[model samples]
Target: MAEDLVLDTAIRDWVLIPLSVVMVLIGVLRYFVSKLMRSSQSPDAKIIKEGQVIIRARNLRAGANFIPPKSFRARRAYFSNEENGLLFVPKGQAQNAQAQMFSDPNMAMDMMKKNLSMIIPQTLTFAWVNFFFSGFVAAKIPFPLTQRFRSMLQNGIDLSTVDVSYVSSRSWYFLNLFGLRGLFSLILGEENATDDTQRMMQMSGFGFDPSKSLGAEKDGLDIVQHEWALPKFEQRAEAVLKKLVS
Candidate 1:
């Protein structure tokens, strides 16, 4: 009996206890390491209300290129958020009316997803670029990466700006990876890839959903009919861009 008890105790402490402790330690390490890694890339930073500060500025390169040594592209004025003390842009639907016209639910969903596919990768590219060269800290970066990307949902006509919210840090990080690859397809003019991206933007939370509006309510934003023209939106966006830049 004594020998058996000793053996059992030995197994409990040496094997079970050690293993359990190691696993717990690993879990903790992973949690922190994940957060550290996430912070390095993009931490879903929050956005402050507009008109709450004096002014802020962000330097945006004309074209997207992550490689710094080769990045001779001219830097342009990336907008800034004074309230949040971060540089970012307010992304919103470029044309709500045009997106509403698709009577086919599948088609609308498909188109929204495609636009989201575009925005997501563009966002990821921006985040990855900021991670290395933006003079931001590795773990303690000051600017909000997620905040800016989330706002881009509005840039697509199918997507409502309100739906853009904080996703888990892990989700945000991986989303960027997938997004980058997807964006490459759009940039290269791959027809299938571009279509896939458009479809992605239209699919509910993954894209835009008229049933669920977000920022519009809070801002008392005017809602045009779902069947509005797309070109008009493009023109409006151009005008807005000019005003913002000027």
Candidate 2:
């Protein structure tokens, strides 16, 4: 059995406290910088209308069973009609819309701004941690961890004997990088650009595609089998009333 390593009190005061404070401050700074750099382009009217249509279609699908069958059919047809439905965009039009989006200089510039905001601070912070606190054990978690967590928590150190709970300076920086989202939300409100996790996800091809979303909503509306539930609800209500009366 390996004995627990005794960390210095100064490590907590200097390494741990400063790293956390710097990370929080960087997040706040990044949020403000991104906000200032963001473009103030007004959304296209056509796109807004399409989004609203998709929402209306989704609501219709969710409550289809509650509405009369004829009404449901009419609503579904309005969205998913093969000939001229609101959701049925021509292949050419979809392609052109996507092409237009990619062709816009403002869109490209906005993407570049977002990338800069995410990357510049991250590079600086990582460099700062590596330069100042490389290979130093910053702090240990209060709970035990398995060997599986050793690689994740002990990034800068290369010791097989070290316990998995011991967090190195570099690893602590990363942990705070991804884990401070909730704190940022508390400080900056929801959907703030301070979260690096979202930026990472966006970089990995998870960004929204309006054409794909609209197509998916149209398909969802098409597959829903509407059935009226009013009669069944009425029967249940009558039975409950009789039970109460008796």
User: Best candidate per TM-score, number?
Assistant: 2
User: In lDDT terms, how accurate is model 1?
Assistant: 0.35
On the 0 to 100 scale, the lDDT of residue 164 in model 1 is 35
lDDT of 1 by residue, 1-246 (tens): 011111235544443344334433433343343334322223112212322211111112212233232222211112222233123323454344235434446554444444554455446644643443232111212333454564332222232222334232223333444554444445444544434434444544344432123233222211211221243666889999999999
Query: Residue by residue across 24-123, what tens digits does model 2's lDDT show?
Result: 9999999889889888988878778888988888899899999998898888888889889988877867665566666667766877788899889999
**Model 2 residue 68 CA deviation in Å:** 1.8
What are the lDDT scores of the predictions, listed in order?
0.35, 0.84
Question: What is the TM-score of candidate 1?
Answer: 0.21
Off by over 4 Å in 1: 1-7, 40-216, 219-246
The positional error of residue 21 in candidate 2, measured at the CA in angstroms, is 1.7
Error of 2 at 183 (Å): 3.3
- RMSD in Å for all candidates: 25.2, 4.1
Candidate 2 residue runs with Cα over 4 Å from true position? 1-6, 142-165, 194-212, 232-246
The alpha-carbon lDDT assigned to residue 166 of candidate 1 equals: 25
Model 1 CA RMSD to the hidden true structure, in angstroms: 25.2
